[model samples]
Target: MATGSPRPAVLRERVAGLMAGTLTLPLGGCRAALLDPQGPVGAAEKTILLNALAIMLAIVVPTILATLGFAWWFRASNTRARYRPQWVYSGRVELVTWSIPILVILFLGGLTWVGSHDLDPARPLKSTQPAVTVEVVSLDWKWLFIYPDQGVASVNQLVVPAGAPLRLKLTSASVMNTFFVPQLGSMIYTMNGMSGQLYLQADKPGVYAGQSSHFSGDGFSGMQFDVRAVPATDFKTWIDRTKAAGPALDEQAYGALSKQSTDVAPYTYRAVSPGLYEDIVQQHLPPAPGPVAAQPASQVAPVKKAS
Candidate 1:
């Protein structure tokens, strides 16, 4: 395969190999998903996580070392060590113990407050590059990505410009699921009949792994997808190519695609039905009854809406 090509399996293996050499740990193999991020959002999130760990470790590490040192200093064999039977409640020790933890807590709290807002998924990224909006529907064991502007759709594959921001409007077509692109940042739940928003940006051209982090049903294990970030020119070329050769995504085709399944391969559509995503959301609810004409107040009893 070409080095600059969009080959998912090959790229995954390469990332895994890089992790093996650079990030080997005692616990298990390196997790490229969380540790090796590919975008600004993911990098920021990783920094927050590492900062929290370091803040806690500042106290934990010193406490552990002090415990060991004290054990050796107060050992029974150390006859020269001072021993006082009445020694208790030293003001210096109390001050040190309380002050260190209080400082640590204050620092962590500040960091959390700032990081949470900075990484808010609903917030749009600050950039001069244009943003691409994708409508994502989480199915039983698959993912559907619809590009309204391009009037095309894809299954289990999301392609976007490398430098342009990606705005995702997501909802579940069936049960609750999560839309996660680990290398691009946080995961958010996709609940039935409700929509969620997430913004992501890829810093360079590459392919990243995406999956449904939340388990839904029997085929949950295979609910995986690929995110391909290419150059702006290439992205436009891809859209044109799909429009020329991909299949049409009509209502019947969508109905068949939304059913429960596993390990589906990626495919594209040249066109999609208008308001298809809204239709999918509406399908989860019971159909609304036809409007009833107004009647005389004395002849008809009043009806109350369901709570």
Candidate 2:
């Protein structure tokens, strides 16, 4: 009775001071970027994800709890246990087991279909400010980001103006890869002969990590970068620094640069060939005959459909 049993000694475990908080939802730094989204598309996607998660957990949580509770209750020692020796399914219970999960699946499928379509990476973000286009080339194990507008380029580091919409035109020179900037947007794939796009914006100024989620071998573990969100004016300074540090990247040089490799450090370039992205988009490599001029209607053969 002495002082309420001398209060249990306060014991604490330090994990770099990042002690986990909450059992259900752990503490996170930029959770707002995901759940408290800044745009309609993000909000919709986040809603669908959350709802789907909750719906699944609705079943999972109860099942796990029931399993544990039933395990203990049905133990041989408990005289209160109602042993079912000749058990048969009840129509009502069966109906519930089937219909409930079916209904939940249908709802989840509907939400996924709608959200995925609406948040299609290729779909343009509806906003007053035009997106800042950045062409991304996935290298051996590095990221090459080209700021076409600013006529600058960099490796492993990308900077964008805060509040400005940004789009990435992504592709890989060799194996496939997934570009994921956790706090900015969802992951999108990059593959040879195919291009993908990801739209994003940073609500506030900060440095966020961007990584290649998919493994691409040797240097896959090191295939990560920094996404620097800064003020518009600061972006200019960044450009100048890039320009001062790196020589111009030309088509011929780019060809050599694009070769497979990984674990590269940040590099920058002051200038690049104009329309380089368009060329790359169309699979046009220098000295490879610009791009096949679009076939004119007259030169194209029109075939009739068979009945």
Please, what is the TM-score per model?
0.82, 0.74
Poorest 10 consecutive residues of model 2 by lDDT? Answer: 286-295
RMSD of each: 14.4, 13.8
lDDT of 2 by residue, 82-135 (tens): 988899879997997788789779888988888788778888777786789999
- In the predicted model 2, the residue pairs found to clash are 140-261, 141-262
User: Lowest summed-lDDT stretch of 10 residues in model 1?
Assistant: 284-293
Give me the overall lDDT of model 1: 0.87
Q: Output the number of the TM-score-best candidate.
A: 1
RMSD of 2: 13.8
- Model 2: number of backbone collisions: 2
Candidate 1 structure quality by residue, lDDT tens digits, 106-185: 99999989999999999999889988999998886888999999999999999999988899999887788899999999
